[model samples]
Target: MEPRFLLLSDVAAELNVSDSQVYHMVRSGELPAIKIGGRGQWRVERARLEEYIAAKYAETAAWVAKNPLVDREDEA
Candidate 1:
């Protein structure tokens, strides 16, 4: 690992969300971040970003599993 870190804009672009959403995530503690200075600059660790993406995927999978479509058929 190269100790990668992402700026707020990069994270917002990666997540396809607004900058404010990223700010909210940081404030709400949904996403881990660090302040660089007194200018409210925030950075997210690459590892943490990956973890959050994985967790979101898992959550979506669980939701889909619990709410299967009525017309869907199991191929097995």
Candidate 2:
């Protein structure tokens, strides 16, 4: 079974991004995460990660819809 929470490295690996990038996202509150243990290690909830991905997909779709691709033939 999949884990309920994931380490920052795991999240970074899944997103194909750097660990620092994920850390920054968490710091910026763009991606929800929690600090645990005496060492204050970061962990992201599985459900929250899924929600973040879905939100990104929706955000990208909105951008694409707003900025329609123009046909190059019209310029030629």
Instruction: Give the TM-score of each candidate.
Output: 0.82, 0.96
Which tens-of-lDDT digit does each residue in 1-76 have in candidate 1? 5559999888999999999999899989999999988886899998899999999999999999999877545643
Deviation from native of the Cα of residue 57 in model 1, angstroms: 0.5
Model 1: residue 48 alpha-carbon error in angstroms = 0.6
Regions of model 1 farther than 4 Å from truth: 1-3, 72-76
The candidate that wins on TM-score is 2
Candidate 2 residue-wise lDDT, 30-71, digit = tens: 999999999999999999999999999999999999999999
In angstroms, how far off is 52's CA in candidate 1? 0.3
Clashing pairs in 1: none
State the displacement of the C-alpha of residue 44, model 1, in Å, after optimal TM-score superposition: 0.5
